[model samples]
Target: MTGICIQATHRRGGFDLDVQAGFSDGRVTAILGGSGAGKSTLLRLVAGLESLKTGRIHVGGRTWADAAAGLHLPPQKRSVGYVFQDYALFDHMSVAGNIAFGIKGSRKERGREASRWCERMHLDGLAERTPDTLSGGQRQRVALARALAPDPDILLLDEPFSAIDTHLKRKLTDDLKDVLRDRPRAVLMVTHALEEARTVADDIAVMAGGRVMRLGTASDVTDDPRAHEVAVLTGWRNLLAVGWMSGNRMGGAWGAVDLDHPAPVDAAWIGIRPERIRIESQPGAGLPAIIKSVRDFGPVREAECVLGCGATLTVHKAWDTPLPAPGTRVGLVLPGEHVRPLTEGRAMAAVDRCDARGRQARA
Candidate 1:
């Protein structure tokens, strides 16, 4: 019940944005989508950079903006913090100076306050270094420390890890998550990386075409997805257009997937996460498939399978499992419980696709 509520609508040119979501108390809510999905726009509106033309925003019992009431607080008056993607630290200021810049106390008091953040962010040694002399990870740490210097009730981060080197991002993300978890404030982070959102956030909000398409816990959204578009966007590998599905049985490009539970009426697509796919050891136990390709990624092996039922699917297996090479014949099985219907009747028409064998199925 305690956290932030945001509702906004803004239309400019061909793109229109409408989002209604919340950041729960002591949790991180990630806004995930492709470019131009309005993730950054929502943050800007909450920070008072964008005009709130038709919505209300309330955080921790404070009304930041309510367009119907003709009230809007400037960013200076709002108790909020923002960490920009590009680490917008003053080029001339040292690390300590940047942290102290957000403090509102006298010069001496500000210096004392900044020292605490330096210790918290593990920047004690780098406090005297300017941004130009620091590495990408160090620069991001400075940006994070500055954002938290004032102890705002809500924190907004716009892809804070995008600029850091890939080798250093995990450590920096862990450092930032520790601070956010221990403090337990309302946080909204915008990132396009699904791995980042799964690793860093408690709740996930998926945006598409200027609207919030799905909102739920990370596991729930990533596991089933429950929609074709969401499943595809989240990197699901085995989504196929099916002609029809009903209780425990579905007929489509992959023939019939004997599900453990009843599927939703008028199903369009059937999907399973790549990790859930398994290579059957016994002959004739699963679907007959021809291996199309196998890709190795150090720890995991990805295999593309063309099912005898005409549909093609991808399966992920561990590197040590010893997979057959391309063009090998094998039996494939989709674990019944993991395979679920991905779409309702509305999207049935949008996903028509031909299986590998030229049989048409709804995508």
Candidate 2:
């Protein structure tokens, strides 16, 4: 009742979105998903840009939309601040003007508010500059300052960093993180990057195929993504479809995983992070694999290994470690604690399957 509650459904073309989620005040929730996951649509529904003809949308106990009562507030009427992917800054307006645009008050009051935001966002000297003269990061700060200027009850961000350069993201992320801290509002951010979500959001809601497959604290969702979709979205690059299972041993095309305990009865996939794999020179220490290739990536070294069953596994180690020669035989130790079992029917692994199909068609 003190934050935002959403139970909404919207259909367009062949896709349907049905989401029921709640965000507490002063917490930031990241909607993590790939393209077409309905992340943006959910944001639109919350901002009143999209209609919910049969569901409810509430912000701090204020009903923005209630289809049963045939009530849907327009976007302008809702206390929401939206930052679009493009930033949507008015090119003609100065930085100060943009930040003060949302505040409805006397000229002096608006100026005073704008100056405060400019200082808060570290855009103090650029107040008089137009949007075209600002850097991408500067423009982003401007957008954020504008959105927060009016102090709305809910903040909606759509791909806020998609357009930023990779090198600049770390600082901007820190800045945004600092801005959101202790802010008494429900902030909803949509992003496909797990690092961004984990670093910024208090909670993460994993979305796929138009629904939230998983939602929990950032650590809980990322550390052990139980669903295949959640695993994929949370940076589990190695997922093996189950070929067979008997007791604690589960065999797939990639090899067999011997769990320390009984496997989940409905397990359909096994996932492990590349960094979780340990390579041993002794053959009998663990599963036998042959190093196929090795690549140096400055801080990290990556190796592609093929198991005895011809399934490929990627292993990552520190760059300072001695690299294994290609074609060298090694034992891969997949610690039981790092292995994740993704249950059947709960995950929509359609993204990978569709990609594989497209690759086949292209070939």
The best candidate by TM-score is 2
> Which clashing pairs does model 1 show?
241-362, 351-363
Tens-digit lDDT track for model 1 on 85-192? 887889799999999988998999999888888887788888888888988888888898899899888899999889988888788778777878865678889999
TM-scores of the candidates in the order shown: 0.89, 0.91
Candidate 1 segments whose C-alpha is farther than 4 A from its true place: 281-284, 308-310, 344-363
Per-residue alpha-carbon lDDT of model 2 for 1-363, expressed as tens digits?
367777767888888987766677788989999999999999998898889856787777678888888999999999789999979999999999999999989999999999999998999999999988989999999999999999888899999999899999988888889999968888999999988998889988899888888777898888878887788899988788888899888887666778877877778888898999889997788788899999988999999998877778899999988967999999998887788888753543322111211111110
- Model 1 worst lDDT window (10 residues): 349-358
